[model samples]
Target: MDLQKQLNEDMKQAMKNREKQRLVVIRSVKSALQNEQINKGSDLTEEEVLTVLNREMKQRKESLHEFENANRDDLVAKVEAEMDVLHTYLPEQLSDEELQKIVDETIAETGASSKAEMGKVMGAIMPKVKGKADGGQVNRLVLQSLS
Candidate 1:
């Protein structure tokens, strides 16, 4: 099913099951997607939907980190739960090995021989790995490859 349809179905299920945390996370994601649609004045394609999901996940991860640093176990648990809910929608993440392989191929293809060409390498790689790999991990691998 398309993500929007699946989200609607899950939202109904969450309501019926009284899964409060799941419901809240789903509603927030739906709200974010709706806001993006309004800003663009168009319905989102699947790729755009994934972009929104990734953005939400990134936000959750950042919050999770901050909560951990602040020693707020309660907030950390809540953000972790939200991250778990968001993970259900994202495509399976790339393994480090798989991402490294792709980075190597992209560097070779783009003739990016040094760190100075990192931008060129990243521009070519992001679309291929979008929604599957974390940007920081990709950046680390590219830097490792270049140096």
Candidate 2:
């Protein structure tokens, strides 16, 4: 099933199971997807849906970090739970070694020689890694390898 339909089905199940936390996170995801559709004036592709999911997951991670820093363990737990739900819908992430291999390949493919070519390497690599790896992590690895 497409993400939208799957989310709807899951939302129904959450309501049936009286899973308040799951329901809340699912509703938030649904709202974000709907808002994107309205803003773009078209339906979202699977890739677009994945992008939205990634953005939501990233936001939750940032919020979790801030909550932890503030010693708000309760809030951190809630956000972490939401993050777990979000991760279920994303593609499997690449391991550090795998990411490094891909970065090396991309750098070679783009003939990138130094940090100055970071953008070129990133542009070449992101499409290959998108939805499978974190962009920030990929960028950092690329810079490290190049430098």
Candidate 3:
């Protein structure tokens, strides 16, 4: 099933099981997806849905970091749980070695020999890794490879 359908099914299951945290996360993602669809004035493609999922995951991660920094153990645990819920919808993440290999290959393909050509390398590689990798992680790998 597609993400929206899967989420809807999961939401119902969560409700049935009284899984409040999971239910809340699912509802939040569904809302974000619906808003994006409305803004675009069309149904979201799989890729677009992934983009929204990734964005929500990223926000949760940022919140996790902030909570950790502020020593708010309660909030940190809550955010971590939310992230876990969100992660279930994302594609399996790329490993460091795999990401590096792709970065090296894209560099060669783009003939990007210096950091100045980082934009070229990023542009060529992102589509290939989209939704399967975090943009920040990919950017770090690309920078390391270029440097």
Candidate 4:
């Protein structure tokens, strides 16, 4: 994974600065990447590495939400910190407008006219927006369009 080099550099910088939380996150990312490499039996492409980072970020966000609801300020803070570090590696998220346009275009392309055709629309849209947009966001917008 080419991004592995960048992660190594960032980890070195974090270690030099004595940033414990940041270093932990970076190390976890490295560990995840290594595991993925072993599973695939080859180095991952940048996109595949991104899929791992994105999954980590999503998990952090969900934990943050649960912590907030449970009044666990301390855990919420930790999750948010981890999320901030992970965000640096993730691709810039698409704007709502941009995502909506893609959904509209996909709807047009797939000829999905009603809610029942949601699967077909999603099948066509996910590949177009993969890694560029969140699946949840695309699902919501597609639901709106079909409804």
In terms of lDDT, the best-performing candidate is 1
Q: Model 2, 112: alpha-carbon shift in Å?
A: 0.3
Model 1 TM-score relative to the real fold = 0.99
**How many pairs collide in each candidate, listed in order?**
0, 0, 0, 0
Between candidates 2 and 3, name the one with more favorable lDDT: 3
TM-score for predicted model 3 compared with the true structure: 0.98
Q: TM per model?
A: 0.99, 0.97, 0.98, 0.95
What tens-digit string does per-residue lDDT give for candidate 1 at 1-71? 99999999999999999999999999999999999999999999999999999999999999989999999
Give the whole-model CA lDDT for all candidates, comma-separated.
0.98, 0.93, 0.94, 0.91
- After TM-score superposition, the amount by which residue 31's alpha carbon in candidate 3 deviates from its true location, in angstroms, is 0.4
Error of 3 at 121 (Å): 0.4
- Put down candidate 3 lDDT per residue, 11-95, tens digits, no spaces: 9999999999999999999999999999999999999999999999989888988999999999999999999998899999989
Write down the worst ten-residue block by lDDT for model 4: 125-134
Candidate 1 residue-wise lDDT at 20: 100
On TM-score, the leading prediction is 1
lDDT measured at residue 128 in model 4 versus the true structure, 0 to 100: 82
lDDT per residue for candidate 2 within 1-147, as digits (tens), equals 898898999999999999999999999999999999999999999999999999999999899989999999999999989998888778899999999999999898999999998999999999999899999999899989998
